[model samples]
Target: MRTLAAFFLCVCALPLWAQEDAGALAREAGAQLEAASVRLAEAESARNRVRALTDTVHAYEAGLSAMRAGLRRAAIREAQLRAQLQARDAEIAQLVAVLQTLTPDEAPTAFLHPDGPNGTARAGMLLAELTPALNQRAAQLRKDLSDVESLRLLQEQAAAQLQTGLTEVQTARSALNQAMAERTDLPQRFSEDPVRTAILIASAETLDAFSSGLASIVEGDVGWTPPEVDDLIGEFPMPARGVILRRAGEPDAAGIARPGILLATRPGTLVSAPTAATLRYVGPLLDFGTVTILEPRPGTLIVLAGMAVSYGKTGQIIAASTPLGLMGGLPASNGPSTGGEGGGAERSETLYIEVRENNVPMDPLEWFSTEQDG
Candidate 1:
């Protein structure tokens, strides 16, 4: 009986372990949203409004992400519990019937074996032990049912949270847009020469050729002292929150390999500069929809491409975590993107990051921090 009880406990534990404390997670989501709101308010009075708003926008994004995750888990857990209960309906009914027949006064006699006195003694002992185990199972059934109802309720209430989070994040992004536009603090490097750029674009045959000849298209000299990143060698900020689709030199489904890494992100996801850098080039290049090349130092360049809407123009000096652009797709203000980045068209928009040192391609993974701060 002890062994069987332990076995039942182990089996029950599987489903219990799969179930997260959704109420706690939902509360956490609310806390995240509240923090984001507070951050949004703080951004208004901060000396560096751009950076503050940027942080605020990211906070909202994180909140929305948490809300979505909580809701998704609740939905799955609720369904799992429901299915388990439903599949065990017949067994539950049989268990109830057996318990009903085992009245307190008559249960011992009903469970007693017909063999003899020795059999009767063993049967009585079995009845004594079985009663508690049956009671335990019945109690567990009630709890599982209660959990299912609670998860269902949590999911139903999540729509309001999602809507509020969506609206606030949109407001934050708009404020950030306005802030970035009005900013006059960042140092100016040099404006790009459109005539020379157009000529170079027309004549260049590849991204490498365009990047190699970019120095000639600059209309003026850059005098701003660029920020050094020696200490950030292995801890550079991630450009955006995403799932890595391919690492440097990894082949895609088409078997085409590139030196850069690719990230799968939700549409309209914010893409920020990994570090302080000057915008060397910001325009369309061959095959790549839109590209922004940043020169963080003398010999290094950070190339980010495939943004749906980019912010800064060529030659603008931007700081670390500054909003550079948005990934292709709808903004996070609309509806949150689901998991399974490997599927979904909206989640399919990718950001390509290439790091170069002295005009030579380097492993992008080495330069980017693995943490998802963006």
Candidate 2:
């Protein structure tokens, strides 16, 4: 009987020991899975960072190229103006010499003698003939002087532009270097699906279509949660600081109804992201100078147009208030002009800001600060 009881106890204990072993194995597997998930997230973050840096480097390069081109053009214009000015100066000198020769001397001469009436009459006729010629030369000198002044003004403007371009180029180069240094070794997000990308690129008819296709692909992930616009309302800042020249629904200079607000800013004004966003596109579009489109959240897009230079690349994530690029040349003078801060020289440029929801245009004024509405 004692032997039988001992056997029964050992058998019952075997099942409990087996259950404990199974539980321990399950816990170990769960811990390993959790660690893998963490590592994958870390890898994705690093990849995004490398991609952003690469895009920034590319943007700086593009900006530098544009600035170099502008500098070359300005140099050419300056040379032409200098040549014209030299020619005008030569013509003026010749006119002065002719005038000096035509003028009568202060001392008495044979023609000035009144002893013979023929001599005096001849002198009077000579004087009359010379009067018209003197007047003509005077008028020509005045016109030439005006042309010189105009040319001088142009040269001054060109010089200023050249200097600005040089400074910008240097700044962009530094930024490029920094970005390159910060870049990490990680695969780019876009390269993950080359086959689909190649197909889209081949099929897209226009840049707009291409951008739309890319946006769709980017937003296709089922886990993404778009931020509510209401939550961001009044919380975001303007991409650039300037006076509002035209509000949405108002007629623009071309007499077309504008879907965005046009802000009059100074040239080379730094443009930044109004909110945390992912860049969708950055390049020239038809009629709209260099443009940059950003998506702050899924289904919402913000468009910044009329920039002279654009920085940052497509698909790069940008934090709020991060520098995008500088505003390009001044816009057409048809837009309203407002004084800037500190009584500085008034320089005006038009920046078009548009916000779209699900690709439908919406008034950006509703989203911007009320204090900036003026």
Candidate 3:
């Protein structure tokens, strides 16, 4: 009897703690929202408004993601507790029935054993111990039910936070775009020659050929070369906050494979430069949408394609984490998202990454840290 009670206690104990964890996660989301709010306010007078706004947008994105994760956990835990309660209905009924048999009015008879007074005394003591356990179990059931209600209410209230985050992120993105257009402080390696770039694009029939000529299009006496980043090869952060939808050479829906990685991102999500590099070329190339070809080191080219709006001009040099552009998609709606935290393509837009050495394609995954990729 004690063992069974222990099992019930164990089950009830877990979900109560899980409820706390879920609430903590939600609070973390709130903290991120506060951070975003502060950053937004700071941007109003910031010398570098673009950077400030970018930070604000990232904070908002983090907050929204945290909110979704918390809500998702709450939903799962609520479902679990509900199922456990339903499954234990019969057991609880039996427990109640047994407790009734040990009530004061019935205890006299229950304590009367065949072995006389000694046996009767022992029976009474056993009943006394078991009664408390049953009471404790009942108390836990009440708390567990309360937890379920709380979780449901938490999710309901989260709708407001989620909407606020979405709105704020959109505002930040718009501010960033405006600031970028008005800005004139970036360093340039060479003055972009559109005529030469157009000629090269028109002459080359394949992507490789076009890439090979990207350097020649913006030829200049660039005495300064970006330092080598071979040591940071496997430590490079992802250019955007997203999930890897496809790895290099992985077959897609039509069984066609490419020598690059596909990252699925949310609408209007900011894409950043993974490292300091010179933009060898920026614009449409072949079938790839807006593209940015960066030369982080000699003989190495990192190709990022498929953004709605790509930033930087050809021959420009940018620092790590500089805003490259926003991914293609409409702003998020003011409600719960259908996307399960950047899990699928339908819920996100794709970013294609291809790395090359001496114009030979290489797997992008080999360059990015896999332990952090999801």
For candidate 3, write residues 1-374 as lDDT tens digits.
34445654654554333435566688678778878988898897998887888788878877877887887887888898899789878867766676666665645565577889897777677767667876877777788888889888888878677766766777677778888888778887887777888898889887789888876776664645787798999888888878889989999999988888998887777888889998888898888878898889888999999998877788788888889998866634423343333334333689999999999999888898755422
1-374, model 1: which lDDT tens digit per residue? 34434544544454433445756667688789989988888888998898888888788777777777788777877777888889888767866765664474645566555787787777568667776876777777898889988887777777677677666666666677778778777777888889999999899987778878989888777577876788888788788887788899999899989899998877657889888898999889888889999999987988999997788888888888889987765544433433222134435679999988888999988988887732
Query: Which of 1 and 2 is the better model by lDDT?
Result: 1
Could you tell me every candidate's TM-score relative to the true structure? 0.84, 0.43, 0.86
RMSD of each: 4.5, 34.8, 4.2
lDDT of each: 0.77, 0.55, 0.78
Q: Distance from true position, residue 15, model 1, in Å?
A: 8.0
What's the best-to-worst order under TM-score?
3, 1, 2
Q: Give the candidate number with the greatest TM-score.
A: 3
Indicate the residue-level lDDT of 20 in model 3.
54
Off by over 4 Å in 2: 1-229, 330-345, 370-374
| lDDT per residue as tens, model 2, 1-374 | 23323433443342211111212222333333334334333433454543443333333323323333343444454455456557557544644665565556776673454557776786567656555755654664465445446545544544444343334333433343344355443222231244655676678765456557764444333232334557777666777656788889999678987688898875546577877777766666656778798877877888899876677765566667666776655333313222121124334677889888787788888787746421
Assess the local accuracy of residue 281 in candidate 1 as a C-alpha lDDT between 0 and 100.
Answer: 91
